[model samples]
Target: MLPPDARMLASQNIVIILCGNKKDLDADREVTFLEASRFAQENELMFLETSALTGENVEEAFVQCARKILNKIESGELDPERMGSGIQYGDAALRQLRSPRRAQPQGTQECGC
Candidate 1:
C-alpha cells in the first residue's frame, strides 16, 4: 500500500506508473513478474518493465503516462488551472518539448526506473 503522502498525491489524480528497471539484468532479479504485477494491480498503477541497457519500453512508458495525463485533462478530471495541481500549459512547455540535444547511446540511456 502507498503511504499517506503518496495516497494524497494519488487522490489529486497524479499519474503513477510502476516501472521495473534494469531488465537487462533479469538474471539477477530479486522479484518475479507476477509479484510486481500483482502489486501494481492492487495499487491501480500502470506496470511496465524496461531495460536501461537496451532502452526497451523506456519511451513507451513515458508516452503511456503522458497519454493518461492528457486524457484526465481532457475529461476534466484534472484542472491545470487549479493551484497545486502540478500541471501547467503554454508556449514554454511546447518549447521545452521541441528543444533537442545530442542523442545518448541506447545502452547508456536511463529513464524513470
Candidate 2:
C-alpha cells in the first residue's frame, strides 16, 4: 500500500515511476516482476526493473517518463502554466533563477582581503 503522501501526489496526477533496482540480482529478489508490475498498474504508475550496475533500462525509464509528461502537456491534461504544476519550460524558467550581474566601475580593482 502506498503511504498517504504518495497517494496524495498520485491524486495530483504526478508522473511517478516505480523502479525495482538491482534487476541483475535475480536470486536476491524479494518481489516478483508480476507482483511489482501489477502493483504499479493498480496504482497508475509506470514500472521498470533496472540494473544500475549494468546501466540497463535507466535511460529508458527517464525517456519514457518524459514522453508521458510531454503527451500530457500536449493533450491539455498538464498545463505548465498552472501554478504548482511542477513544470518548467523555455527561457522563462531559466530567467526565474537568473539575475543581471552588476558591472564593476571602470578601473576599479578589488584587493584580496
Candidate 3:
C-alpha cells in the first residue's frame, strides 16, 4: 500500500518527498526536525535539512543522498536501462567524429608505416 501522501506524479520512475526542518525559528511556528525526519522515514523517503544561517550539513546532506542513490544504482536496485539512468558518453572526440571533418594537413597521412 502506498503512503497517504504518496502520489504518482510522473510516469517515469521518480519519487520526490519534501520536508521542512529547523524549528529554532519560533519553535511553536515550525515543524520540529524530528517530526520531519520521522515522516520521511515512515514514508521511505530521503530526509535532509540545511540551516541557511550556519550552512550546517548543507553540502553533506546533498552528497550523502547522492552517494545513496549511486549505491543503489551500482547494486542494481535502480535499473540502469531506464531513460535517465542509462550510461552517458560525453567524450568530445566522439562528437567531433560525427560532425563534418576539416581538411587534414598533407604531411600528416592516415597510414602509419
Candidate 4:
C-alpha cells in the first residue's frame, strides 16, 4: 500500500469507492454498515459490503465503479485518448519489478518475529 503522502489518485474528478469485505460473517463484524455508509457519503465514495465466499455485493461494487468511470468518460471528464489516461502500472509496482529485490521463498524469513 502507498503511504499517506503518496496518495493523490483520488483527485482530479476520479471516482473512488470505499468497500468493506466479509459481510457474510456478521458475528465477527467490526465496523457497522451505517458507519461505513456514513463515511462513504461524507467522502463521496460508493460503499459496498462484499464476501468473496458468497459473492454478495462484489459484482455490484465493480459495476458501480465501472458505471462511474463510464459516466465520467461520457461526460468528457476522463479522456482516454490522453497519454496518461486509463489503467497503467503505478510507479511503486514498476519499481518493485525493476528493483533488485528477489522474491523470498515461503517460510523463510530475514527477521524472526
Candidate 5:
C-alpha cells in the first residue's frame, strides 16, 4: 500500500533509482544483492549497491542516474514544460513562456484611450 504522494509520483514518467547504501558492511545486510537486483528489474528501476565510506560505486551510481535522465531528455520523454516533475528550469526559458498581455485595472468603466 503505497502512500498517495508515492503513487502520484510513480504515475509520472520519471526515473527511479533503488540505491542500497552502506555496502561496506554487506555482512550485516538484510537485503541480498540478488533480491534488490531482481526487485529493480521487476519495477523498471535502476539498482546500485553503493558504499559511502569506501566510496565504492558512488560516483558510478550518480553517473548512471544522470545518463538515464539525459537519455530521456534527448528522447523528449521528459518534458520540462510539464511542470513539477523534478525537472530543473531556466529563468529565461520561463519568462519566454509567460503570457505577454498586461492586466487591466479593475472597476474602470472604459478605457480613456
Candidate 6:
C-alpha cells in the first residue's frame, strides 16, 4: 500500500502498474489479466503484463505511460517543471545520460585505417 501523500500524488498524476516475468513460471504464480485490470481500476492505475524474457509489450508499456503523462500535461493537471512529478522528460539531461552508447572497436581508426 502507498502512503497517503504518495497515493494522493498518484491519484493526481497518471500511474501505470506493470507486472513482468510472466514467461518464467507456471500460471499459478502469474497474476491474471482480469485481476490486474481490477486492481488498476480500483486504485486508479494503468495495468499491463509483460514478459521481459520475450521483450513483449516492453516498449508499449513505456509508450502508454508517456502518453498518459503527456495527456496530463496537456490537460493542465500536471506541471512539467514541478518537483516529484512523474513526467518522463522532467530531467531531460538524465535521460541523455541513461541512453545506450555505441562502443567503438579498440584500435580501430575512424578514417578506415
Off by over 4 Å in 3: 1-29, 84-113
lDDT of each: 0.79, 0.77, 0.53, 0.68, 0.72, 0.62
Which segments of candidate 1 are over 4 A away from where they belong? 9-11, 92-113
Among the numbered candidates, top TM-score falls to 1
Residues 26-95, model 1: lDDT tens digits? 8999999999999999888899999988999999999999888776876777766677777767765553
What does the lDDT read for residue 40 in candidate 4? 78
What order do candidates take by TM-score, descending? 1, 2, 5, 4, 6, 3
The TM-score between candidate 2 and the true structure equals 0.74
lDDT of 5 by residue, 1-113 (tens): 22346537644567778899999998899999999999888777799999999999999888888777666765667656666657755787654423433456897564222
**Number of the candidate with higher lDDT, 3 or 4:** 4
Q: What clash pairs does model 5 have?
A: none
Which of the two candidates, 1 or 5, achieves a greater lDDT against the reference? 1
Q: Write the per-residue lDDT of candidate 2 for residues 1-113, one digit (tens) a residue.
A: 66558646543667889999999999999999999999999878899999999999999899889878766776667777677677757776544322323466899874311
The Cα error of candidate 4 at residue 55, in Å, is 0.7
Off by over 4 Å in 5: 1-7, 90-113
Candidate 5 residue 16 Cα shift, in angstroms, is 1.3
Candidate 2 RMSD to the real structure: 12.4
Give me the displacement of residue 14 in model 4, in angstroms.
1.6
How far in Å is the alpha carbon of 88 misplaced in model 2?
A: 1.5
Candidate 4 ranges beyond 4 A from true positions: 1-11, 87-113
Model 3 lDDT per residue over 7-113, tens place: 44332323344434352354554666777778777766777675556666666666766566455555555554466543333575534333334567988765211
Error (Å) of candidate 3 at residue 63 is 0.4
Pairs that clash in candidate 2 = none
For every model shown, what is its TM-score relative to the native structure?
0.74, 0.74, 0.53, 0.65, 0.67, 0.60
What is candidate 2's CA lDDT for residue 20?
98
